[model samples]
Target: MARPVQTPAEVLGIEPAGAYHRLLLRAPGVAEAVLPGHFVTLAIGGRDSATPLRRAFSVHRADPVADTIELVFAEHGRGTRALARHRPGDTVDLVGPLGTPFPVADAPETAVLVAGGYGSAPMFSLAEAILARGGRVGFVLGAATADRLFGVAAARALTPHVAVVTDDGSYGARGRATDPLAAMIRAVGATVVHSCGPMPMLRAVTDVAVAAGARSHTAVEEAMACGFGVCMSCVLPVAGADGATRLVRSCTEGPVFDGTTVRWPEASPPEPSPSVEPREVREVREVWEVREVREGVRS
Candidate 1:
């Protein structure tokens, strides 16, 4: 694969969606190569600071035709707050379509997707691919309240069965998203399942999918400071094919993996993913070296 790009992205626009903002950016080659589960890591701080830990975001949508990519986020921290302040024509350094993409490796009759909070970021792309394969998709989205839910209306347009769950019952259903997942899969005779969310929730959804006899895929929400495997910060304990437990970098081995094999915190001895020389590791060391150094950022 061609190496993921480290280029200056121009802000195209930002649209408000309840409590979240869908931020669009122009990122040439990056948009064309992105897959369903891929993400980008942007350098924060400023140009010529030499370094800044990256803030990762799932590729909410990538429009190759427009050479633009979109990310949906809630401003929960300094990184995202900075992202929210960007205006059209502003530039940010980006590195992506990184990480292992959701395995569209199988052709299923029906696919069920489960999301928790911002984990909904990656589902639309996966849904598009599933539809292209002549498969149907259904979503079970859950958040703290109605406003925390990300893409319910957009999801409703993509798939007929979009169910939302909020703890306060301010949305489509009460309780957790997993509450209705198993029944939905069984009702649709779903042959495959995909999920992205908090680790605890993924663990629960994986159990439900396994019990329902549906093949499952997961896009894990692991913190990746490097957006590549070098940082060793985002390790996940997973069952390797050899039947031995191993720790793998979530940035490389996955942001996506077989749900059934991930060793959840309580289930097994947690082994750290072993180190491997990552392929397609982008040369972000010189990020934006070509963009004329600019002075002054927001105070």
Candidate 2:
């Protein structure tokens, strides 16, 4: 839990995905303090031009040695379309290293990481952390098709065991990631499940984990006008320890919460959080392509 900071990061590179981009930056102290699941807010339309709110993105990766961080996102609307135009060497406003991180157990135990699309962003860091501690972790990644699967290659490097699911059989197994989740948990003898994705998908994951007697935690995706709690726009109903349901802000109280305690309320689509925009929704449905280009001078 390090204190948050507001600073500008010099964009080092941009990888163009047909529909999204991977931005790498030289962020002074961001990587040093960031942990798995922490996110940063980038000012839309760049360095105070007129956009009212900053966009939040999970910390995809942090390299303390390089003093850098990476983010993956798609440009969907007015604000993000502007964000997508940034070129290397430019500066982007950032406020964070914010929100709760996926808690890694001190003792070694097997873990099952479930990610949907860019939800895979934070999971890569979490998986790395878990493995660094000599614990075992597996990935269960899903998307609409092969082009959308975010971390299959990365997950494979971390562990030989990865289960990939897609709605359309474009690649990997054809089905929901959770379709094989229960069996994956049993096969791996997992002690816990960590998940992130659409609300309905998360709700399903919670149920599967609970039935398996495994503890579960989920990183929620909500729209946020502010990365801090002040906006009051990212609230969701989650039951408290005493069993009383209260609306909580995803920014401060959590983007991460006990899976079992969340109350999605109905089978309806998740409530809108500021982060809920067209680009994100489409990317979540299925990821866009990304083409990594470094230094501009390089081919």
Candidate 3:
């Protein structure tokens, strides 16, 4: 692990990737220290913004040689829209190589990496790392539609086992990405699974990996008010190796965690509570009682 750095990174370029934007920044120190699953936080809206929170994005690509790092993100709010407006020469204050990165196996092993939407960003770097370490890599990428899917070409460039799934059948298979994960893992003889996506998708990936008897690592997309560990905003319940589920900060302890270790939020329907009068009905009944008492007093 490397110490995170806060530096004023100059924007090198910004380009569109499907519905998202790929931002390149000149931050040699942060780029050099970044790992596959590490992310960077940029101060958006400049100095006059009301909110002081920084926007966090996974490190899509890190080029220490070029002294640059890339971040991929969709313009989801005012902050992101502001970031998207940055030009090549603009300097943006950023903190990087934050959070726990995906753990790569020292020994070469067959592995499957999964992504949903722009969550594919970090997986590309992770794939590169795995391949460099002589590990076999396969990708399962899914999104609501074809335009929403990303990194299909990038994944194919790394390996021939890339699987694409779209909810609308716009491209590839018409289903969730996890639909093919178990088969792919078995086919590839993968002993490990890595995933980054929506919580439900990650949960499904985790379930599939566990069923396939493969180790699972998931990078969560939790909202962080502070990209560092200060705010405790990105805390989630995760189980320890000892099996105790406790709150842990995603910023420091992890944005990546053993899939099995996360105490995933239960999806079960809420139990029916004891019957109670509606507020409106109670209020109407009270009004009726008051009227009756007034009539009796008049009588």
Best candidate, TM-score-wise?
3
Model 2 C-alpha lDDT per residue in residues 171-277, reported as the tens digit of each score: 89999979989988988889899998887888899999999999999998776777787756676677798987766677887888999888764312432335455
TM-score of each: 0.86, 0.87, 0.88
Off by over 4 Å in 3: 266-299
Task: Write the residue-wise lDDT of candidate 1 on 182-278 in tens digits.
Answer: 8889776788889998888888898899899998898887656687888666766778889877667778988899988887763222333344423
Q: Cα lDDT of model 3 overall?
A: 0.84
lDDT of 1 at 117: 84
- lDDT for 88 in candidate 2 is 90
State the lDDT at 186 in candidate 2. Answer: 87
Give me the runs in candidate 2 sitting further than 4 Å from their true place: 17-19, 47-50, 266-299
Steric clash pairs (candidate 2): 16-291, 17-289, 17-290, 18-289, 223-273, 223-274, 223-275, 224-274, 224-275
RMSD per prediction, one decimal? Answer: 9.8, 9.7, 11.4
Superposed Cα RMSD, model 2: 9.7
Judge candidate 1 against the unseen true structure and give its global Cα lDDT, from 0 to 1.
0.80
**What TM-score does structure 3 among the candidates reach?**
0.88
